[model samples]
Target: MNGVLAKYSLNTVCNEAGCPNKGECFTRGTATFLIMGKNCTRNCRFCKVAKAAPEELNPEEPLNIARAVREMNLRHTVITSVTRDDLPDGGAGHFASTIFEIRHLCPDVTIEVLIPDFQGDYVALKAVVDANPDIINHNVETVPGLYNAVRPMAVFERSLELLARVKERNGNLFTKSGFMVGLGEKEEDVIALLTALRNVGCDIITIGQYLQPSREHYEVVEYIHPGQFKKYEEIAQTMGFQYIASGPLVRSSYYAEDGFNYLKRANATAGGDV
Candidate 1:
């Protein structure tokens, strides 16, 4: 069913992170394929993706990803990847190419791209933004104070800039980002982070509880309750986000289809087509 994705010279965040929603997303005919090799060059605390030398980019990847997504019956698909800092363009070309191919394969499907920071490469970010996917998501995984501790190789401000630049480059493309709580970040810090993202004109926000994947990775500091998540949602909605997917289960793409539907409806209404 996912032959094209398997054959493509790519890997996905969904698989690397051990997401709980994978089975449901796959069964419901959706997947967030990772492109541009599985080896990430950066070393983030909470992530399990290998840190090593990445292989050469496969030119046929776009075609395979497109065909596989088509065969998978995806009405809404997400394409994300491990950070490939080894590449000159930070794998931005591959991300854009995959989006183009997926669009050609499933013209009716809404494609959301959970992209890398492109190493704060504005031109690289623009390249992907210029492709015009339905949504562009860059995750600022934690608060600033914890960013260096948790994501030493990743800059918190740079991630914010990526989201800001994407919106600047593609006003119509729904801009999204996420935060994983329970990594020792305080409630006030979380709110401030959310506020900063909103200030940058982010259209969508996902707030989820972080579950540490392995002993070698970051341990789960605290397990947040469902009620806390609801409160977060309320706060996020008030911050002017168009869509807020908040819950214990809400990873960036947990409710992949719902996000697409929300964006489509909002876009239609904005255009006075509703």
Candidate 2:
């Protein structure tokens, strides 16, 4: 998987973000493709992706990613990217093109894009929404109280609004958002965040432990237990999320295909799509 992604000059969040599940996912013949560029404009403290001047957009990237997906024979392909605030449309066109190319090359595959906030630009967000991927995910990496330390440049309200706007633009779309626990957030704080997500009509939610990328990054205040994750999942499900994935190793795109399929089956059983 590493060699193939390198051959196509592609990146994956699983690698760039230092995801804990990358080794397992790679061994299973799956990966979350990263597009736009390697460097991110926003230097979120919890992130491991390079924080520097971003590279110029690669016009051939969409086709390269499509070919890689076809070669990998991925039934469900996940695409994410660095926060390219330097770009006018925040790399939305690149995301759209990649979706289009992947759809053309692998018509049977399901596409999931875990996108940046586009700095709260509705037009930019709409560009990707208009592309019509199977699931659109934008993670609010930490709670509001921890945002200043963990994600200083990101706005929690804006992230919620981004999810809200996605639903408004296309009600049929399965909008999703996620946040990390163990960042000094109380149980009430987690519940509040879930309420905000539910109010915005987010269909899916993910909760994970906040593992510090390095000593230079924000410290992980605690390592949330597995049982706590289960409790959070129960709370989210009770609050009406169609699906929830919560655990210590869970990331926004972790086990994403399974979550989507679970929602599909649940909807089918419930007599209609949520």
Candidate 3:
């Protein structure tokens, strides 16, 4: 998997973020492609990606990601990027280009993009929405109360708006978002977060435990038990979420294909487009 990504000069969030499931995902022949550049402009305390003046956007990155997707033969590809606030469009055009290129190469592959907030630029967000990927994911990351401490640069409401806007633009697209527990959040906070997501018409939700990346990063407040995770899933299901992935290791793209397939089956049964 490493060889294939390197061959195309590609990067994956699995490697960049030191995801625990990388080995398993790679063995299963899947990965979440990271594009634009590895260095992020934002210094979110919870993230492991480096913070620096990002390098120039590679003109060939879109095609390269497409080639890598084809070579990997992924049934569902999740593409995410480090926050690129420096760019005028926050790399939304690049995202569209990458989506377009991937469709050109692997027409059958499902595309899910875990995008940044685009700094609340609707025009930039529109660029990605126009590309029309199967799913558009913009994680809230944590409860609203923890935003300043856990995600200093990200606004909780802005993230919610982003997800809502995606559905408003195209209601058929599967809108996904994720947040982490173990961030000093109370049970009510989690419930509120879930409620907000559902209110915005988010069809899918992922809840995962927060693991401190380094000593300098945000500390894990508590280790949530599996039962609690299951409870959260049940709560989301009752709230009308089409699918939920809740567990310790359930990152945004974890079991991504499973969620995509589940939504597809449910949509087909409901006589709705997927």
Per-candidate TM vs. native? 0.94, 0.97, 0.99
Report, for every candidate in turn, its global Cα lDDT versus the true structure.
Answer: 0.83, 0.91, 0.93
Off by over 4 Å in 2: none
Highest lDDT scorer:
3
**lDDT pick, better of 1 and 2:** 2
Give the better candidate number (2 or 3) by lDDT: 3
> How should the candidates be ordered by TM-score, best one leading?
3, 2, 1
The digit string of per-residue lDDT tens for model 1 on 1-274 reads: 3454566544666677788888887676666787777788889989877788886788998888888877777788888888888788998888889889988878988888898898888989889988988889998989999977899998888988888887778677788999899999888998999899999999899999888888988889899889888988999989899899988878998877787687678878788331
- Over 1-274, each residue of candidate 3 has an lDDT whose tens digit, in order, gives 9899889888989999989898999899999999988999987888899888898999999999989888888889999999999999999999999999999999999999999999999999999999989999999999999989988888888998999999889887889999999999999999999999999999999999999999999998899999999999999989999899999999999989999998899889989877
Better of 2 and 3 by TM-score: 3
Query: What is the C-alpha lDDT profile of model 2 across 175-246, one tens digit per residue?
Result: 888999988999999999899899999999999998988899888888888998999999998999988999
